[model samples]
Target chain A: MKIAHHAHKDIVIPNSTRHLVTVRQAVFDVIQESGFPEHEMLRIALAIDEALSNIMEHAFETENLKAELTINLSLDADEEKFEALILDSGKEFDPGEIESPDILTHVASGQKTGLGIFLMRQVMNEVKYTFVSGFRNELRMIKYAHDFKTKGATNAGTQDHYQNH
Target chain B: MPELKITTKIIDHDITLIRLVGFLDAHTFEELDVVINDLFEKNIHKIVADLSALEYISSAGAGVFIGALAAAQENSGNIILAAANENIHEVFDLLGLTQIFTMTDSVETAAKAFECNA
Candidate 1:
């Protein structure tokens, strides 16, 4: 098997959950080509899925906007890291505002959602949110190869960072 | 339009074993929800989710089980998760669901879990 030293791909999909599977597959393929372990690749793909789902559910649906919306997604993978950039022209929402829920309390309360951002933060090494007034919201997430190798399938030492620019 | 496929089999006359294949994400979670809801309407609650063939699961898919757990327990039944591949299990582990749900190695073990609880 030949390994691609560096790979970059871009995808644009309507702001709907229907396209999440395709996007996840695309991310997985790119990360696989970069030679990330299957486990790590799955985590990276999952983080991207959560981010996109958040944008669709919270960023667009919250405002009751019915206009046709689209999301721009870019995937870049190399020996050191895999990065995903999601750009959308939806509401200015920062994931940092939501506190991580107590798992016991959350499940006991009969809540079915609100765990996407938490999962994204757990899987990605960096999750930065940038919004330019009157423009678009950009969410950048990166997972480092070293982090996954050291952390051993858990987010034990991973730190969650969010930035608004 | 979603990529998930859900098939159900009744085991031990009461437990419904749902085998999931393909991706279960925001697009297809509602299908699982509807299946569980229909079971609840029929007063059947003991469930063992056979996930050996399930390739992926996202938060939305996990939410269906979280949302149904309470109702199943209140009805003197339970939901057991079985044979989740490493990736699928990681999603549950990430959400702290491992502590809340009983996961087994096979459908036989999961079916016995319902018996053990009973």
Candidate 2:
């Protein structure tokens, strides 16, 4: 079974951070529709949020910002898998080169930026970055429930979720 | 974007405590560097970061920590993480930083780790 959904909204102040819940819910709905648990859906949602945050920040300049963020969500019922594509007409960026901060070191003192992309690489089964015409940026991420490569204790189908600790 | 909010505390004469909250992803990751650099001028060599309120982080954000660690180390200072959730620990474990840096379950323990070890 294949579940597909697409959401397009203009760049508005509310959409920046506040709308993360809405965007995440739309994807979670797809996970539920696909017969997956909440934990699986959240992993997908958080990944989407990270991708969209990058697009909104990198694609649109802070001064003349108002770009559209398009998210395509697809799930394979037979495979028990989820995939999302984040498309933005923002500036060009490649997260691959960004090195992950040494958490041990940061734990002792300060924080860093490139850690976001690194964490995505670890949790998601596949993450790809591409640019079309140096104007549009695309981030495609995919994960399979059966793979069980990346996980948190509160994954889909699990009852306990540490919403806050 | 991970929001890297910085708060400070006085730990002994040389150590400074930094509290991080919200998501510290790609968007606000760089700010961590700027904040720490400014703190360097204040002679904060030993640092303890409270990630209790932090919800999310990515590799790029991880890079910030590494850079700050190097910077602080050069000045004979150190960075320690305190009270990280399982998800955050997973990140550190994957990167093999668990062995290199000190991690504790709580802020108090984290501070003691740095004061005793680093």
Candidate 3:
């Protein structure tokens, strides 16, 4: 089970909102090079941005340690998959414990929290979180290249791929 | 500085039309929040967000609307979405905002909703 990739890039930046554009541009460049459609490319970038925001909001809370966040972008040629891996040196948190926002109820009540995780789970084909040793966390977001192809598969009816832990 | 431009147009003293161009994410969303808050302060409750040129929006951008819409509803107004691209629509749909928002094909039609209600 080997999936060959065509393009790959690794980026590291400080844990700050200002660096979101840097990460988004890198993911956009890689996704563009992978020949993914422009619209889907933007969506992927948005998902990656949300993940980065989550790291800044929760993981880096309580203290602004001089830390760095790593983002890895890769496209599998054989499987036509695009994946982004975000690693952070922030507090350990459980992604499974986050519930999907009752969007309707929440919207009716004016709550903005919880939509970041929901967007990550909804936009990307797959999203996973892992807690590495000692205050390290990795969030993975994946999208199928074919899903954005002009004549490729429609995203409708695709099974949810977000996993716990 | 985020690469986003927001232009606001006040119509009829009750409706505020905002045009969003470029991307909306955590960094750039504050610009939107500021404009919406200013509108609320002025007692302008109804809003129409023109997203025809909006290239991207993260969840935080969408969250801005959640708060704006709720406030509008409380003030007997509404936030109408107009000309959203498929990508923007997908995010809105994923969050089930379609049911919560009144989406129209054009700003003309969205503006008419306010007229009809009035």
Q: Which candidate achieves the best DockQ against the true structure?
A: 1
For model 1, how does the per-residue alpha-carbon lDDT over B45-116 read when each residue is reduced to its tens digit?
Answer: 999999999898999999999999999999999989999988889899999999999999999999988888
Instruction: Please identify model 2 stretches exceeding 4 Å from their true place.
Output: A1-35, A40-43, A57-79, A90-118, A127-138, A148-165, B1-5
Colliding pairs, model 3: none
Best by TM-score: 1
> Model 3: per-residue lDDT, tens digit, B11-86?
6667889999988888788899999999899998899999999987888888898888878988999899999998
Q: A1-165, model 3: which lDDT tens digit per residue?
A: 333336677776676777788787887777666555555766677778888888787776556453454334333312377777777767876565677767778987888667887777667766667786685676766777565552332465222333324
CAPRI-style class, candidate 1: high
Question: What DockQ does candidate 1 score?
Answer: 0.82
Q: What is the TM-score of chain B in candidate 1?
A: 0.96
In model 3, which runs have C-alpha deviations exceeding 4 angstroms? A1-5, A35-39, A62-79, A146-165
Q: Kindly report which residue stretches of model 1 are placed more than 4 angstroms away from their true locations once superposed.
A: A62-67, A148-165
Instruction: Kindly list the per-residue Cα lDDT of model 1 for residues A1-165, writing each as its tens digit.
Output: 666678789999887898888898898888877765556887888889999988888777644453478899999988788889999988898887788889999989878899998898888877778887778888888788787554444555345455566
- Scored by lDDT, the top model is 1
Range of the 10 consecutive residues with the lowest summed lDDT in candidate 1 chain A: A150-159
Ordering by DockQ: 1, 3, 2
Docking class of 3: medium
Model 1: lDDT of residue A101: 88
Please say which candidate is ahead in TM-score: 1 or 2.
1
Q: What digit string (tens of lDDT, one per residue) describes model 2 on residues A1-165?
A: 555433232223232544555565677666766655456654566667666666655556755445344433333332356666666666677776566655555545545443445546655676767777655666667677766554542333211111111
Model 2: iRMSD?
5.4
